[model samples]
Target: MKIRVTGAFLFNVLCTISYTCCGETVGKRPPHIVMIIADDMGSNDLSYRGLDQITTANLDAMGFNGIIFNRHYTEPICTPSRAALLTGQYPIRLGLQGEPISAGEDRHLPPDVQTLPQLLKELGYTTHLVGKWHLGTARREDIPKGRGFDTHYGYWNGYIGYFDYETKSAMTITSEVYEGFDMKENFVDAWKDKGIYATHIFTEKALDIIDAQNKDIPMFLMVGHLAVHTGKNGMVEVADEKTMNNTYGYIADLERRRYVDALMNLDDSVGRIVEKLQQRDLLQNSVVIFMSDNGAQIRGIFHNGGSNYPLRGEKFSHHDGGIKNAALLYSPLLEKKNYIHDHLIHITDWLPTLYSLAGGNITSLKKTDGVDQWLSISQNKPSKRKNILINIDEVKLYSGVIGYGGRYKLLNGTIQSGFYDSFTGEPQSSNKMDYDIAAILNSRVNKAIKKSKVPGKHLDEALIRNLRKSSSAIRNNSKCNRGTEKYEICHHFCLFDLWTDPCETENLIRQKSKDDIVLNLKNQLAEFWNEVSPQTNKPVDINSDPAKYNGTWCTWLDDEFCIKIKTNNQNKNCNENNRSTSSIPVLKL
Candidate 1:
């Protein structure tokens, strides 16, 4: 006997089954998320990226076993990139596209903006932040605790001394330089941990959070490391004497050696975090993301002896060296692993992508400029993003602007008069030893196979190694017509095919066939400029001086509020005695 069912009836039956399965899946716990951000790290800083001087064994292992983001982009500075990461929106929309939020500046991420931690908390996950919180501190409501995290264990300023934990700030109001301790633990001064190195301290705190997390409840932890960034007085803080003396003696440049020491310490932190997750039996259900905030400051303010060699421009320019960052994602959830993702990815995409991965409805994220790239990343699908508005800050010194669409990139104006638009770093031949790519690949691949859930599956180590080498070759390949000429400031406009000339060595403005591409990019920039909000930067408030608060950077405005209220009450009493109630001023509070 043959039976035929109506199409509508069959479809209704399938829909009912799908709904039932979805309901059951929603009751299960989501994956744990651990995001680690490095400060002022360079594109070529990692050994896997062809920097022969430094050895990042742990980072290389993660890259080899996970997905290496070859074309990831971030803001050219600290605060903007961070803001974009947490809010899933362009910094221009949030008034955070200007300079970083300096010490005592009355600038911060807008209070009404929904942050990543806040969203994660709503999804029944515990959230913690354990590093730099350069977002804002003008009000008690601007710190990480107020923003969404359950706890914060780090500094509130941009950068601080590695050991002393002191931040030096030049007051915009008084023009006096003030230095004070800046470490904090959940809104209180963390004075006891002053002598400890920041990388070690932050790592310990992250591990503690992971260990204490409830297995039934998912966790979200963000480790914002202060390593690789310049410390007090613009110096790269090195590790202890014994470790430095035992290793990194091959490099003659003292500054570069110090940077390598700091970087290795950061790598150790990564390895420890992964090992801890494995020991806790959380490795199978955890997703780890590692990224740098922006490119290194090689030759400008806060120069850290870091390098973004082979890519033009440094920390503040609108070039690849400034915005193209080092990033990778590792997780058991990925269907495809041990490959490079060359698609365009912006920092803003993290919020929405992670939210979707946590089983949240994408429609809930309102007015977000970021596209959900979870499927693109996990399943190896094409990226949904077509164009990226890098940045347009009219308030900055150089009025720098950049717009990227398709294979074409358009730039207008420049940063620091394009002084950093040249390759700058320690020479590639500084070290006599060559990097052993095969050995690193083989080690990582074997470890990954041991931990694999699939039975009898093997990774082609040679193919993976070739993938890494080819990706590096493509990134460093430069086909430019101009030889030995600096990429000068683009006072008006400049156009280049980034696909062919990643170095920005050739200007294609005069080519008639490319006129349409230039016009389209300019239009995109104009559209972005139309929607930009006024920059939120404010002059440094002298009242924020730590001298008034026992040599610690506290929420000074909170104390100021109490003082103002007391004075207002006194004035009100005096006015009442004089029979002039209307003279009493009403405080806004």
Candidate 2:
């Protein structure tokens, strides 16, 4: 009799497993999603990440309630990060080896690659993007509505003096600067510009969108904020340690009070969104996510704006400081709280995860570089990546290298360009030197060169297909030569924990690893490189004349190309100055 009862119980469990395997997952119910991204906020910039000086209470609250991923990652910079997130494909795969659109032009997502939003929209979910949209130029592809999103609002360019109405007005005509595109352009001029602050206005607009979307259909809102990207003009001047000024830094400078103000405004934006969810009684049903595009720039006059603490380097460089950021998953479906899920998730993973939760049929969807983490999360399974990959400006690796397996975050840059740590207030230093790396830096004779012939990894057919689609969308139809690119090689060492050094300050790349481990990592890196090296690099399209500034402040020393940006100003009609209207309604959250 006892055996018969036990057999009956086993039979019931098997039946349940059969139902799930047949695709009737869980209760077979879909979940709603909201993904919020912050621009240029470093991995440790927020209070939630344990910053003592800053206050991000609301985000902290969210962190407590949701599962925080300590190892969330993004591409080294803005555009490529966004591109990766949108297409679930690698930037190199899409041939976007650098910044998204060129200086003064428009680029579109290749029509072939299917973006996350388009997939959700097809599944009957409403989609919207508010705040910074730098993945491509909206100049001609002006309306993102043409892409995957159902609604969109934000700047087309990377940075604008946040509060500079004049510059904003100028952008509508030409992408040039005025006498001032400074954050103080308003306060420095705001005393006269009347009432306008980009931070305040953009937040208002987001909330408005959220409030109006409270109807019956499920939704997907990609809220990318420019709060911390840059204030304007450039990074704020370090007036002094006690009084930090705002040129418009992402986190804030030393002026802890005002920094708190800017931080509060961002929190206010989040709080309002939370309130909307509660008011609509949708808090429990909605899945909220937040992250940053890349590491914050932590050097020079812009030094004090914010810090990534222990992480090395800043935005644009491939370092932990530049590539790491906060990531979270908030769902009422979870039975746990105050948990830290120590796993690695890349920016490109958003599409598939959200699509699956939203009841979207992703099987028929186009290819993506990101793996669906939903199954792992709900079941508490292990991570998909046993090996992680990284690429910075002019860096490369080889394939089948052994020790590269397991978990690691690779950092690559020549000795001269070590990463800067804002909290430590210094550029990282090493006692020893790579004789090979130093040799390349020691000379500059154009005629004497040794061609490197190491083979890199090759992409699988599926990854190649989606990458091509994403690249074609943004590049339109342009052929680019990638022969000019160069990359430095380094072990995938994010911040190593050395055995001999108790303080753990040493980098394990050359110090602690066994010779065999190093060889293996090299091989794995080579495999990744082979797969990505053949890809096309980014395209630049500046409409200005380079000859205009033979030797002037208009020129920036780009390693590969001396980027010369000359301003061309034109007068607006007299009617424009006098014409005015009431404030446009701002969308909340």
Candidate 3:
């Protein structure tokens, strides 16, 4: 990997921040980018986006002034989208096609992949991450500090008992007893070991990172808050049993209100981070982007109420509600208004865009999977982003046979996690045209996946075969899948025509003539499949028995890896008498 540095040209490292464009020579002041991401703020829940119930004043103000992208797309889940956002390519492209992060493994992003933080770090900017890092965990090497981030302060795993904050940094890692992550470093241990609420501490660390810096270079701070992602321990009652207090409308989701309270507090942290920048006279020269990793977790209908209302679907499914997050970008470089860009942009595109905005030499870097789109956003240019995004269970279907093109998305036959238009409030649905499109989206995605394939691992094709083995009498005939697939409830393959029917009420799978659309899409899918043949490498089959695909079996946290626990721990099973029993459902791709 050749290191290219032409830093003196194209960027003026000395201009003070400004308010309003004021013809501010942005090129001279190359803005400091601060990407703030909320864990699970819903698509229609933010006040700026037209949600009446919740008030995201900070985000709304940012949207009111800067550019609000109306058509942002992710994997409708956490880990994949976050990976895609940082990589500037499809999560599938990088083998991160399933779940938020890997189950029971310290699944670091592949070493060869391009990461936004790494790119910025190489470009001479101080990079930092503070908050949930569901992307990878379980090992010291898998921590964020190792992944281009110069500093980090947050939990390595998903959750902890009441009142806790844990941290791992480039210099030191404070360990606590956590069930999922660094068992040595629990928030309670952080609370017990070092009185800190992970959120507030991270905020302070982020602010401190900004303050303790000298004027040697600019900064790129990514505050990926983990609040609101959990059911409600921070703001409201979270556990079902805790809802006995019964103060809110729906008491079952106490975890949700606590989640909201935690979120509200996080907003204050955002305000503080912004204020620090302003105080340093850098806000004017900084670009602030706020959004969630994915849609709301559907704990209870209104528990967290991470509303995807006008859109459809929730976490775990690839519906609009799941993938289309509410995003706002603020910069003096951008105009002040409720400007919305409906162009289709996914998380990965940010890789190149961030580089372009930072004026980095991306062309000479082999790890990048992004496209520079700053000029496009500033000039209102059309999107040239990928048309398709596909993730074959446990495999990233990007590049080779499964890459993205334009105006299309491809996917394996695993289509239950759907796509739709719940982006706005609830739909009125007289628009039969959109409904018509909704009916065909699944087939379209499947077709897209089939056509996007160019070469490399053929795990997706094998996973598709495994799905057909669910009802088989014996497990031996199933695809030689190394692990069992995870299955959610009746999260059936759904469709919606955002161009016409956004509600996604009228399912098109049963439609008689829908076969034509399905067939057309399947053919397109085949094109991509042949394009990226797993045969090139003679990829060894993991499963030869299509009948052995036992994804329906349950386990903790909807993670497929947990399924093997039952088989592995034949002596130890979920028992009421024993406390080792876990309630989390195993979800496999």
Candidate 4:
């Protein structure tokens, strides 16, 4: 027997032989992951997604060339959605499910949660984040740099002025601007005061990171664009004048025109980054995914001017318009391109999927609410995701749970019919799914799943158990009603099938012989509440820490009240409010 070296010894010998004989080393390099998230972008914002008013050529191309997620869902707001994305868990589990991270509020992603960057870092990937980090900024270990990103350059709050880099706070009584590197290193006066539009500045910084990357190491970049979200003064504070004038020359309304201009600039940002990747010879080796944090602001809130027509509610509601977002995934590793995936994908799925794509084993990670659908996604196979527990939060004025299983979905306590079919770009009708659509998508995913050599079903038992519990408790308690006493079950509960009627025009709760379905959904909703509700934490008391706001009140000498200082030049006389006698200039509300 020729020495009979096998098993571990044989594997080591084969590895040595491959390294010596084959010029290539350590298998294939992991693909670089680029996750581009847009703030307040709607499902129909892109021309390809049925937007006749706006033109998003680059975004359209990415969708057309990549995989389109017709039914991808995110949290109804910004902070919770981001938390879900990073932690691969529902925001409720992270205690950040309630509200957005407001200025100076001492709350953040819990330190125990394993983030995407932290997982990728173990795989030897260099991680960098550019743009909105609204997850948290309360403690020193709560920010992006402290979490996992090797380098972070952006604001930690929700919406900031695109040009001024400031956000108006009722608590602060002034618009505070934050621009800096790691918050831990420099929390005070770290602004650059470049006066450039926020979108452009963020783009340049992203390019710099990409250009400076070492080719040997795989990279993961998260570019959170602050475009489309209204600025401090409203939506009119900033927009590329040249692009705005050129694109919407015929639009009469200034605000509407400005909104369109901001959208066009957002599209351009997408194109520029793709172009940069192409020029760097990294496009083919990169995986690019684009999605919105939540639905668009269609109701003119904060002077917003985007539309989510045909879909129901705006950003902060339980309607599909609020949770169902515009999303696409592109990569050379994917066998299927120019396709629409109708499978239910939640915001939490990205972390596990991406971590696996970067050569991580999903089974080795901390128990997450996400499932590894890499095989199903990359190859265009039928997604293994059968049910999705959207969210249940009592934090907002409109609070309820949304759950989907098979062709049926329930919103709150009322049940309706119909589901939005992304492939046909319309709502599914009757009790049947479009076979032609299924065939087209399934064939591609099946092939990819086969080639991946990984099992399509990567659901963890713990996650499944949790989901099963949540799905069974939808309308169990009357007190759980989102502060509304209208409904008998849970006061604010409304249910819809989403398969037969996508617009939620009819309620099937009082229908004939649907008690079993209604009871199961109620249990599901109740389970979510019982598990996630207790995790929600209260916001930190900003009044307890006055030192954090020192010198950060008025950085600009030309603010509305600052005009008094320029003419008077009396520094000591500026403390009119007596809020702080420390001599820091305060903006009188």
Candidate 5:
């Protein structure tokens, strides 16, 4: 006799199958995830990467003990990179691949997309955001709280003043600048935090959350630091005056010295957070991630004196220096550690990777450009990803299209008026002051390693020396012969073997042997561009100006005049054929 199968029985069978595919056994407690993101950090800014100008002992320790993703990539700018991380899909799919969201613009991450935090929340995790939320804020549903974060304690716009917590935007029509307080604590003005430095305040809030978190339920905390990014006036903010003047006084460039101070404060925040995790007994069951949103802006808007030396291009370009970033993962759950992973990985892979690690069903997620790399990351297996569509932007001028497959990368456009096509940043120089890496290992690394209970491993001077040697070997092997040319132009098309010429130093379009590779990558780029969504960027809304909202940048779509202005703009666009463009009315004081 045949057994009857009902819908409920089929659903149960599918769930079991999906769970098995997730690579995690049922009934196991999911690991806590703590993600720390730095804004506008350079590719070679860290001390562990052989940059002798600045020291990042805490971050260096993490790299020394964790898996360093040498080929990890992100978008060339802030909004796109954050969108890819949160949704596990390319920003082009959500129309966010254009320029970053301005203070009063109407663009934001689409409301219907399920975010990483939302998925974790379904698996019994408490999600919190403790820093920048640059996706969107024009609508109430676009804020962090509305997008699955249980609580948000930071600024809603892009970068803000470290001490004053203010955002300034100039009107499109008249170029009139408007300034306002941008900090908020879960949808209200956090005026009390105005005078406090952002890094210190954000770190304290994270520590508090960790201290008060429920032990039974898993937690997901994201610390989006404002360090290394320039303040409201396009100047680097110094966190410690004495440190800059005395410790880093040897650096002739004052701007670079200020930036180094800011980075040190960020490093201090990392150390404190890790120490808290160990104290709270969360170290053994937690996965910690540290990364930058994108490459640094060496010279431009929001310039912070950052350097991506030895790599070409800056923040807004598609070059390796612009999109390639330094990232590492640390946890006791990994079977692999202390090695540089050279396989290709993209920012979009985090959504499915993290979800699978959280014991969620990956088959349930909608069609995404990202693929699960949990096994590849945790088990040291070869990456399942073969190609990455860097970006395809049609709205912004000089914004290019890029694609990577196998060992080759293709680019068809330029960025920043093609001014940053060469290597940018400070010259490689010797250290003026010596820092003790052994002290950090003894004080910070050994304690955490002992608590983590991973067997047969001890961090010491020999281990660190070995790690530095291996890392240097990887870096040296990837370097190609630098061309004597001053600048490499890519106005039409350019091809380079990323495995050999990681710096984009030589364009191989002239080689006859690489025709097949170039054609294949070009075809892939075309397919990605075909699925591009119309960019959602809108003109600056003067009605959303902070001057009208009690001197704070806020959601103004609820106000009567704001709604009326939106309607008026819509009507004006509809009747443009009968009216002159200059007839539009300006905002009245």
Candidate 6:
């Protein structure tokens, strides 16, 4: 026997030896990560998702080229969802699940929590955050740069004017666009009257960041776009007249027209970012995640013209439309593409998932509500997360939780009766519900074991039986215990099988053989709540006291700019006297 090593073979051998010696395969580099979050975008907002009125060519292409998550869920509002994504914990745990953080409020996301950027930074990745940072800006320590980002740009308020970037409160009003390398020392206002659109400015800076970053180290850029969200002072503006005129071409209704224009501009931003990545020859080596903080604000009195069609309820509710969001993951690194993965995913999960993709160990991280689903996502394998606690709206005392052990799902507290295909955005027939659920669950589990390198079997016969029985118990044991109220029989819960009824239109509370399921779920809810800490909403001192605004952007609290600005006047249409009188539903969890 003779062995011969050619020049090419020796080169390959040397490369392999170098990798084993230094953990690098010749010139290979880590993938860059970009996360683009759209504000107040709904499930059906994009044309690709069946919105007849809106055109989102770029987002549509993202979904078509990457993977679309048809059933991803988030909190019913922005601040909570962002906190969950950043901290990898439910908002309830961080005392951020209530109303959004107002401009002058002293409350903020706890600085001690380990954020996604902080983890990435520890992994030698440079991180930048552009656009809305609603979690909190009441203090310097609570801002993005303080929370692990290397560079921070954009507003610190809940929402700001598209052009002015000003946010108003009862006491003061100030434009809140600033940029800095460090929040504690170098923070300074970046845009006040730049004449550039918010969406466009954010994108321009994002491209600049990409261009300026060191290519040798991986980068994580989070563009938290303030598109399609109505401004705090009731302002609704979009691209300039010329841009609107040339692009959208005369949308009839004023509010709706501006909305479409805003959405279109957002699409343009995404297109520009992708184009920049392609131009830099980084498209194939980058992973871009596009998602909404929550579903679209479709039913507010001053509607933003965003749609969550085919799914019941809107923002601030417990239905699919409110919690379920439009989401997509794009990357050439993915084993599969151009497909929809119908798995249960929570906003908190992104921290662990993205961290794992960046080569971090999931088990070594602090405890969080999120489960690392990198394999399930990139490989199109079965999800390790089979269940999710949708939301616990303390205001309404309503909670929606999913138990995906078997085909059965508990809505408020009962079992679901029908089927709704989240992938197709359509309801299914009740007759084929059981068979369909079992088949899909089985196939995904088998594929995960055979093809994916991850370990976990979320669906098994024994687990399904136990989960089903528990859900039935909860429903049956629920009794009428009204305190200082009318003595009436109320189930206090609603049930739906997400596999069969993703729309959550049909309630199975009236169905038989569901007592055990309800009781178990109720018990589980109690346990989950045990981990949720209470929120402390520190009051904003908007009075003419300069001392009160020391740490916050509320220095303008005494300023009457809210009355002086013409844009504020233009927003009078959404004022208290002229606002829509349409009623928003208080969802039954």
**Full-model lDDT for every candidate:** 0.77, 0.49, 0.50, 0.62, 0.78, 0.63
> Higher-TM-score candidate among 2 and 3?
2
> Tens digits of per-residue lDDT for model 1 on 1-589?
8786543343334334322111223223477899999999988888777677765777877776778898888998999999999999999999999989988788899999999998878766789999999999878899999999999999998998887778988877568887777888888777667667889889999999989987766789999999999888678786575677568877777777788899988988988787677767776777899999999888877888788877777888778889889998878767787788888888998998888777566786876888888777876777888788788887753433344434777888776667766666444434556666555545533354346453333445575566568557755464532356566557668887778888777778889998888888878888888899989888888878766666667787787532222254664563344233223222110
Model 6 lDDT, residue 379, Cα: 70
Give the best candidate by lDDT: 5
lDDT of 6 by residue, 306-394 (tens): 66656655677666777788888777666666567667788898998877766566787876889887777777777788677766656
lDDT of 5: 0.78
lDDT of 4 by residue, 28-110 (tens): 56678888898887666665554445446566556555667877889878999999999999877888777676665666788
TM-score of each candidate structure, all chains considered together: 0.87, 0.67, 0.64, 0.74, 0.89, 0.73
Clashes of 5: 0
The candidate that wins on TM-score is 5
Q: Can you write out model 5's per-residue Cα lDDT over 72-142, one digit (the tens) per residue?
A: 89998999999999999898899998888989888888878889998888777889999999998887788
lDDT of 2 at 28: 28
Give stretches of model 2 more than 4 Å off: 1-29, 100-102, 106-108, 165-195, 236-259, 300-304, 361-365, 392-406, 412-416, 419-504, 511-513, 533-571, 582-589
Which is superior by lDDT, 4 or 6?
A: 6
Candidate 5, which ten residues in sequence have the lowest lDDT sum? Answer: 580-589
Model 2, position 131: C-alpha lDDT score: 64
Task: Give the per-residue lDDT digits (tens) of candidate 2, residues 225-338.
Answer: 766755444542121223323322343233333334555566656766665665555555577787877876665423325556555456655545666666666566554434
Model 4 lDDT, residue 353, Cα: 84
Q: Which portions of model 5 show Cα errors greater than 4 Å?
A: 1-21, 24-27, 397-406, 425-435, 443-446, 474-484, 560-589
Q: Model 4, residue 379: displacement in angstroms? A: 1.9
Give lDDT for model 3.
0.50
